[model samples]
Target: MDRTLTDIPTAPTDRVYIVIPLFNDWEALSLLLEKMTKTVAPALRKRFHFLIVDDCSVTNYASLPTDTGYSLSIMRLWRNVGHQKAIALGLSYLADQPETHTTIVMDSDGEDQPEDIARLLEASAQKPGQIIFAHRTKRRESRLFRTFYLIYKSVFKLLTGKAITFGNFSVIPPNLLRKLAHVSDIWNNYPGGVIRSRLPYQSVPAERGARLAGTSKMNFVSLILHGLSAISVLMEATAVRILLFCVITAAVSTVVITVVILLRVTDQLIISQGAIYIVFSLFIVILQAFLISLLLVFIVLTYRTQSHFIPAKQYGDFVEQIEKVY
Candidate 1:
């Protein structure tokens, strides 16, 4: 039987594990942890457990104070595997714990907003089966970043026929914890993997919060890689779209070339040097288009033959060590 949030009731004493992936941003993380005590409601505070996953931080997070009214623990990874993978590893760890009923995944960077946790919990309580996402109703990023983000979203929709607007700020019910742990794509991209997994989720409106301190780690190059990873999960769909585009271009070029040749041969129209140039260009385009289409077909065929790991079954290979700190 498939599990749902409604299948499990949360008592006032039930615990909610908030999984936060950390790298070197210990300052922001400390502040966020401190803010959670006051920002989160008092009743909910009693049941909150902060599961901070350290992605092999160079800076020591061990000294950070954790006596802020809620129970706290940090799970250190073997090495830095980026934020997305860190979150996956954290979820994989929590899935095995019988005491954990609900898990919230968010960034250590304050942009996820600790204040919105209340709203997310409220939505989850009202309707129990689906995962809840803190959808950004407004952003605090620069104009350049916003422009690139919009472009990325457009290209993603064009290639995959799907849309993604949420990030790591999401609440997962117990039912999805184990299932998501099994999705290998989460190792690369969390939001994309969840979308590909076909998990039912609802979004709550929230404004993006500014970082408490320091510059963002996501530069232009990293942003491009992040966007490509999202597209990579829909590789078959994107390849098919590209292949179809090549076929359409080849067909259109052939027809235009044929018409131009016919007109020139019949002497109905004057074929200048420019017209001759266009005919040759169309031929070259047709040849290249067919070549690309053939290559894409072979790639799709090759991808199907490769074996991939299911995280729930093979996640141990990635972990170096697990530590608990309170």
Candidate 2:
């Protein structure tokens, strides 16, 4: 059904904003807005406002229809600040608004269900200080994409010791939103920061929907980079494992070499053959180098606090301007 902003209900004090971070998916965004306005619960209809952050879209926003009656507002960032950063900007904007008490962030492609908004709101109301994330029970993506996502989720859990099976589709309470606003590293790590925060959060299972229109903006390279960025949060954990591996390998090599030498000297047999000695020497040298490198990494990490090592400020600014029109 087509909608003009007038179709949406409004109240002076009841304020809830839905933030859709748009990149190049203008067509998909249009359909998403239509569905949201027409299908969302009436109780949620009155206070609902829609904020579209055009992440430096190459297309002109003026060309897009804005007849939807909901308090529609568009913030064209100076440039494309990427998906996560764009969402961060939207959250910041809502948090600053006196009327906005709850904010929902979702993708513009319509992969997240609009009907789930009510469920998230109910969950948020029950847990006032929590963030309600939409957890997908079954993903209607390609086999390759699903496989990669599953592997990535497993690896992330193993490294970070945190479970994150969801993405940006979430309803954040005002209190939690305030806390997130104060977080300097939110854009850089995106969902990682939310998971690491260990804040009170709940998840509602939502059925995934097909894209409303247009191709997805996320390419293979972008997905890989995002995955790496998320895993970077567990660098400390990976470094410790590397250090332990290096030390154990070095110690085993040393013990083997010493035993070989002692057997050659005390026994009638020449246990330390030339080939054996050369192989052992090379192994020890390589292991020692690995150990030294890990030691250096440990020293650097020790001197730098978790926040400093990640360099949240620089990362945040980089995210802030990713789509800024040049």
Candidate 3:
């Protein structure tokens, strides 16, 4: 697939849609709507539409204010399919619409600045086929959270060999959006699919802000689950890394063994220390080699069996049903 962003007409049209995934932050949602109405470019304001995909929040937002002077629509999911899935559903909905040439996905909590939308639009206009990712330059989060995020980024890069620090805040052109809509293994990869798609894309630095309303829905458990799911997406690469480590260990063990035999022959071996160290090191090398080989075999089997794969159609159907009723 050709993943390249091409510059297109910048004339404002009724083709851009801003989609926000919400799960009960009515106050912040309201604020976000208000900010967007005031912040969007005048030429594009009349043509742009706002889509709020409700992820089964306990509170009913059907009666909330909708008079934002722009085309506004709310799509309530039948159940909570999580944030990522909800975003996918919103994009899918827009993808089905003929006039949607570009779609922007953002969080409803106002953490993602509304003013940045213009920058995204400009970037998209410069490179029509690219997805403009809003990467946070400075975070207002706690130190511990920042540390964890750094670690996650490091591991993600090591495994996937791609540097992606941003999350869901991005503007995807219609064609790329359609491609993502058909990605069957999206749930397994989260944002990995975006990078792996290798479509023309660019990243713009933005500052992170505190939540504009209710408490964050993400907890420790949810974060850990998300991390593990991301890791699973890059399992094949990780498996290769494990194999490499095992090979290195084996090579080191061989060299150590040769050195030990030489020392013994030359009467240069420290009898007690040399014997114990060599034996322990060799045992660890053998054990790690076995474990790594087993892990590689398991990953291959899982990939072949499609054990953890979730088809995109199934995900789409599930979300469609959720959008049908309470």
- Stretches of model 3 off by over 4 angstroms after superposition: 1-13, 98-100, 304-312, 320-326
Residue-level lDDT of model 1, residues 102-179, one tens digit each, is 889999889998889888988988766788998888888888988898898899999998888888999998778888
| Candidate 2 accuracy as TM-score | 0.79
**Whole-model Cα lDDT of every candidate shown, in order:** 0.81, 0.70, 0.71
Instruction: After the best TM-score superposition of candidate 1, give how far the Cα of residue 321 lies from its true spot, in angstroms.
Output: 2.8
Q: Would you estimate the TM-scores of all the predictions?
A: 0.91, 0.79, 0.85
lDDT of 3 at 184: 46
Off by over 4 Å in 2: 1-10, 61-69, 248-326
lDDT tens readout by residue for model 2, 192-240: 7676566777788988899998787666677777777776655565556
Model 1 global lDDT (CA atoms, 0 to 1): 0.81
Query: How many backbone clashes are present in model 1?
Result: 0
Off by over 4 Å in 1: 1-13
For all candidates, the clash counts are 0, 17, 8
Looking at model 3, residue 72 earns an lDDT score of 62
